[model samples]
Target: MNYTADSIDNLGISLRTFSKINLDTVFIYPTVANKPYQIALMHKAANNTYSVMDTYNGVTLNNHYIASVEKKDMNFFTATPDTNTNLGVTFRAFDSLVLNSVKIYPSQIGVPFQIDLKRNGTVVNSYTGLTDSTTQVVNLNFGVYPPDSNSIYNLVFASNPLINRDAYAANTSTIKYVPGVIRILNDTAQGKHNYFYDWKVAAYNYTEPVPVNFLIPRDTAADAYKIVFTDNPGAKRDLGTTTSLTVPDGLTINTSTDQGYYNYFYNWKVRTNYFKFYSPAEALTLFGDASKIYIDYPDTANSQNVMDYTYCSKMFTYLQTVRMRNTLKNNVAFRDNLVSTSNLAFTGALDAW
Candidate 1:
């Protein structure tokens, strides 16, 4: 519906004097004598801020247009403001949504002026420039982040043109990102076997294209591993005796949520080595008092069986496995005996037994 000064004046005609008047309807009303008419109250427009031009200040407003990320455009005509003799030129409008803030960039070279900011027809903030017609940017309004960050703020540039005759004003809208209300969980899960360690991770962010990294200890200090992922459940592998590893593909989340979150698995295999030697020649052979270097074990455990004899080159293989209990800590042989019978076996006997 269109509203204008002429339409408002005509709507104020007395129905008793005019037979053509639709006085029976609530939409028609007698005008208040000697009072200027105003536009009736109405709901705000969807997804847009209302703006108009003021010819008194040489202001020329163009139609507003909405643009999308896909380069689509939707345009709406600007609503001409109805002048108020009492308040001069005033605009009563609202923005489509909550906003982060507003800023004004003055393009005219004149006196400096203040701009008032509002939302839902309520004054929120105001900003004043330093000098007359300051050809720079100024903040008109500021709001809470993470909440109104994506909202569009309603703006009203109010100035005393009579006092600040040298100032001119122009402003722009700003939108920002505030973290969303999302929770994340990152944890490690133990597998059925003690040799393996599994992990699970999660997180949340406010935007897309998130970067992430995962850190895990190497088998040895000299090894290094770097993982570049683009999706969740990124990479999973068995950490063999090798000390080095590489990151697999498709582990990045790319979203603000779970930006740099990660989880992992590490399966460690305990290692132990054993070796023993002896001779089955004559008792106390020529080379009497035989001696051998005994390499110590990092941890201790009981051996099932071992050999006490050796002839030529005896073969001694090491046995490694997982323990159900703390045998290395409580076993007597693990503490006192350097080598157990099951730990190693010899093919030959000692020259003297």
Candidate 2:
């Protein structure tokens, strides 16, 4: 499986397999020195058309001539454009996927240019930057677009100053095409040019399997949970007898769907306390009493000056009987006055003492 060329695209590898075997890593050895190469996997259909499966972009000749490739969700296909023409390519996503970026070969470096990702002749996302290299990858802000069928996309390129110059790399001899992934519709400038640019269109498969897990509170009595999609309200999934839930393809967690828990406390508050005290009551009783107190106090505070008036009143009532066993052993009337005055009398007594 040795491919020696200045540039390669759509290189095929035939594998005859009878039993299921796992492919962990792919090793690619590039004889050329100091060159970067992209290795990708494409699946051939029964109709003899090919679609991108997975692509590895980190392959280069710098890693001791051996590039260990791993399967990623990214898929891309490249085409060579005409260097003499300032044209663009119109294509369509054969499957539902996120259009990640488009890498183009620019003729002039450091020149300002704009690349637009248009859907059905309308610009949806645009990338503007100074050309820095021969291969400039333009990234889009929108993660996904057209989200459905019947929508076509165009990758239009334009340079500043409006000069008739060589802006992109194109191929006139062979027009690269990947069905059900990316199919060339037409040329933006010339109709039916039968040529495509040296543009690398990369995308992530929307239906690609992504592993997901959900964690539920241990104290919650909800034996069943339901996950609802925000984008599609009608779509829902029920978690039965398991805390782990299944995430379907094309649905993003938190972004596209919202997880719901039934029979659980909706309004809950959290408080952190560093001081631990041993109580004679049961754990459940202590927990219940602690839940009612929203404000926490350190073990020692000088004169209760920092306490809020309302919270201080609540704390004084809760600790009134306990304080009676200490310095206020015989001061029942004083404790009552402290509570009635909203702990102001207690503050005055502490200041006087």
Candidate 3:
């Protein structure tokens, strides 16, 4: 809640009250973190001498006593700290960082907060929710797209963006707050009006539907091989491997045994199946039958519908003529003849030497 010059204090407050006091170089610290801070409102006098206000609380000192006032040899001031702006942390971008979950620490739980994912300065995704009163850690999660693998990214936390941010000042009030920040606090383990802190993130590298080819080891034994994959679509496989593995048959593809190698290093998650087979014909028949059972690919680059390049009729979109890319030598004879440097004989005589 944004606080205006209201009769009572609220969470979202805007402090725009500028004073003509001679207080400069003022130092402040919170008796406790995320709470009201005591400010040593100071003044200057003869020969530019400095005088400190003798109170920890924000006290309006008399103009006459402003100079010779007894300095309070105590710690801090009793003024609320008002930060009315969006605050958050930034992280360096890596290849395919698919961040879908976010966590933050708000000093005052239960208040609403906005969390956004900024990729190259553009907000590609966001999640907003009220902080749960029971827990200090606020969580916001949703399905999100993978931001550009090469661009910089930042996570921004702010008050409810839906709320309009026009801060009002009440009559006869000098102390104020800035708008944009949403803060709340209680007496126990709290400083001035509480603000948010300690932001944490969990993300993973982006993964796409991969094109994989298994070249069965060409052996004279005509042995059988088993290949298994865990279907982990739309999950952060970049944080090492999230896929479980199993060696189906004693005859294993030595490479596929390690989950990390296939999940993180190789980027393959076989969640749904394993192929145990022998001979190209058997594999082809099984694949054909499996395609009917599971209608996975219709018409995409990753589809199993590979055009038979051996025949001209199957290559519809790509027509193969006698002339290939290398045979695209239009007017090659004429072009080459010009380069040979031939001169016409008796076509013209030298007019001047």
Candidate 4:
């Protein structure tokens, strides 16, 4: 692109391309000193209308070539102390940015001073400390400040003792700063025609979303379960189970081989083990049925004599007594043996009587 020095001094040149091209950086050389400039990308539609794609602001020419950059800007010049004791400036931002820190030239080194950043006359942040001769960057600590084209922001600088300071002002008796992403309007306390404190501001443009990579451990089990991500549609991945070893089948009790002993044992061990005690009513509900019993005794005429005994009535009477019932319930081994013997005898399978 070819442009004249007059155009570079007064108006910035714009070069249009026949085809679309991606731009990463832009370089500009200004003919004048201390002139503010901006770099922007514009898109032209079919209707010959232009829309801004991106913009970088608060840039100035200082007799050297500079590229369009973001995040930080510093403006400093040779200055002498003036009569002003307290200095402040008001500005507006056209885009979202974070105010990280501000650099100020202290009139009196090692003197206690205060800096206040206010929005709409309300102080949002404040910093008070002794001025340093080497560094004057006052950290704001406020993470991000939204863009407000209408609201005015005031940055105030004050000291305990009266001290003279030099500030930036126009020769035409006006605020002398260019309008860009961040625009300095005028002095807050003194107004538009007064001296405003020169400041170097550090800021950040809102960043774009970054792609993140997640490292997940592989599943090693043969029967590993998979988790499905429903939120990330179209980005689903079939990460197979990591393990190759098959899980052994759960151990099962063989009740038939154990003469059905395991059938009741399994029930008692797995189901009834959770209960600490069974109520008397519950025990009666479980084993309250009565069965016929034949009692055998020695008779005078015969070797064995069989007599029908009312065992149910006697058993009910014994169970009705709380002491007897508790004794049977507490002695689990005795109760199991008595139940086994009674079952064998009732079925005529008792071998040893």
Per-candidate Cα RMSD to the true structure, in Å, reads: 35.4, 25.3, 32.0, 33.6
- For 260-334, candidate 2 gives per-residue lDDT tens digits of 212111111111222222222432354435333222334323233334453443333323434444544345567
User: Under the 3 Å rule for N, CA and C atoms, how many clashes does model 2 have?
Assistant: 11
Candidate 4 Cα deviation (angstroms), residue 72? 13
lDDT of each: 0.23, 0.37, 0.29, 0.37
What local lDDT does model 3 show for residue 251? 23
* lDDT by residue (tens digit), candidate 4, 8-88: 111111223221222222223233344444433344455655455554443333322211212122223424444353456
Question: Please, what are the lDDT tens digits per residue for candidate 1 over residues 193-227?
Answer: 11001111111211121111111222211111222
What TM-score would candidate 4 get against the native? Answer: 0.31
> TM-score of model 1 relative to the true fold?
0.20
Write model 3 residue lDDT over 39-60, tens digit each, in one string: 2222234454434422232321
Over 4 Å off, model 2: 1-86, 135-144, 158-179, 188-353
Error of 4 at 252 (Å): 64
lDDT of 3 at 53: 28
Residue runs of model 3 more than 4 Å from their true location after superposition? 1-86, 93-110, 132-135, 142-144, 160-353
lDDT of 3 at 48: 47
